[model samples]
Target chain A: MIAAVGLVLGIVAGLIYEPTVPTWLQPYLPIAVVAALDAVFGGMRALLDGIFDDKVFVVSFVANVVVAALVVYLGDQLGVGAQLSTGVVVVLGIRIFSNAAAIRRHLFSA
Target chain B: MSRLALGRLAAAARPRATRGQLVAAVLCAALGFGLAVQVRSNQVAGLSTLSQSDLVRILDDVSQRTARLQAEARDLEDTRAAVTGGASGSRAALQEARARTRTLGILAGTVPATGPGIEFTITDPKNHVHADVLLDALEELRDAGAEAVEISSVGGEQVRVVVSTHLVDAAGGIQVDGTLLHSPYHFLVIGDPRTLAAALDIPGGVLDVLHQEGATGMVAQQDSLTITSLRPAPRPQYARPAPASGR
Candidate 1:
């Protein structure tokens, strides 16, 4: 219940404040969001599987975002930014889907 | 031994929900919040309104517009250079002299002119095409910016028709510089074809007057109308160039 309230508060604050991301950071925001989504799904799956760990979840979330952004930056330097962004999105999307399927199985017992 | 050791290490590092469930929940909440915020901001950024093809089309349109504007600018620059550089003393004097010679040649009807212009043929079946009607046509053509004019009788020699010196003969044929032109006079004019045609065809204009006089007048535009009849330069016996006055 506390976690649900925190999420609601975060959403209300975000809507009311409407903070703008810095221009230099704009390119990385989409990738970071995708990575965060992957982490959230993985955490949810772990929770259903009885292995949920806050430390592991937070660490993985931060690491996922940071690593995704770094890969994109490296791709830009190597003149393959678009290709690498696609690659990253595909991998993270597959992981999210698998975790979501696992969570579904846990909840439905199907 | 290596497989047993690796399995032991993985087992030791694995997380248990019983110990860190609260932290896990908090982190999951944060992740959800961040995702929502990113999605909202991206929506507000307005990049989603344009698809990839739209962006490419916009880029192409901008490039084409730039190219057209650059070409116009180049043309304007060339005109500016021509005006400024062509006005320097010796070049200016030469250009002035050439212009004066051309004008004098046109007025004197001694030079052939070929340009977009109009031609008109007046058939005076009853010899009712009077000198005044012909004069009116000349005045109208002059007002309409006709650079050169020639008139010839049906199947006769073409003559440079000068307005100031031509007269209508008693027999109703036009006489220009001792040459008698009969009915069915064909006029060749060099000027802006549209303007010249409009001037002659205006309501109650020269064409109307000619039609009233029982003369059939027909005007047509030509891409290139040539007037080749040359007139002898008038020998001025008295007027001579004055000596240059000293400052």
Candidate 2:
């Protein structure tokens, strides 16, 4: 119960705390946002299994977080935040589809 | 009944685990641990990073991006040179070069500080380039292989330039909207001087017209030109026009 609360609060905090994304990367905001959600799903999947590979989970988690931050950072930096965000959204979309597939396979496949 | 239940419980305790379940278990544990760490780090780093000066980070990011852009611009310039020099009369290559040049030009116009290039001085008799004229000049220069262009007196009422508009002016001078500019009408255009000059001089061009009108326009091919951003003016948005009805 405590952990769940902490997770909720942490997410809320993250939402409240704005990242310093560049103007050029503004478009990627949705991408990062979506990617973040996908990352959480992926993270949860790993967490659900008792035998978890820290390496895989950590690496992907870091990549997802950093990339999200980077989309904003580089976007803000280049003044093409929107354009960069578009690119980020494209990448996030691919990740989302892949994650969704994994979820479907895991939950539904016999 | 108690003894039988005890025996079954003992047997169930030793039941074999499936590989799929085993893998899932491990993965889930790992994710739990990793998430714990991610949360911690995010809390620490996110707060710290946010608390830190964003402007400084922004400047650093800008500098790094500028370096990358400059390199890319140089690469494009070299490719263009090689293509032109091959003189294969390859329409495809020329077209590609032209297309890339225009794209780069538009990009450079958007981020004037990104590349190492030249400067241009466009003098307005009234101290401003007409909207149509400014856009024409910018497009021509880009087509001519200008990697970047900076106009003066941008970022104020005196100057305005967006993707749609051709002309921009400041209170006293003109700007292309990326950088605040001043006159003797300095236009910092970055690219190959000779080729760029020829591109501007194409038959029946804006440059020719400007020249015919005795406007002060000079293109200085430079080893390097610096483009920096000035404070942006508050952007304007359109509202519904009020209807005109007789009271």
Each prediction's RMSD to truth: 17.6, 36.0
**Runs off by more than 4 Å, candidate 1:** A1-110, B1-92, B242-247
lDDT, each prediction: 0.78, 0.56
Local lDDT at B240 for model 2: 62
Residue lDDT tens for model 2, A1-110? 22233345555554555344444433343444455566656654444333334356546655775777676676667776556666777777887777666545555542
What residue pairs are clashing in model 1?
A54-B24
**lDDT tens readout by residue for model 1, B140-194:** 9999999889988868978886645575666658776678888888889999999
Please write out the lDDT profile of model 2 over residues B1-247, one tens digit for every residue. 2443334334423434645334434433333433444454456554332322455677789999999999999999999999887776688788999887766545534433445555666665744345566667778877777655556542322322334434455565444443445545555666777777777667877677677666767766666656553234334587665789884
Computed on C-alpha atoms, the DockQ of candidate 1 is: 0.13
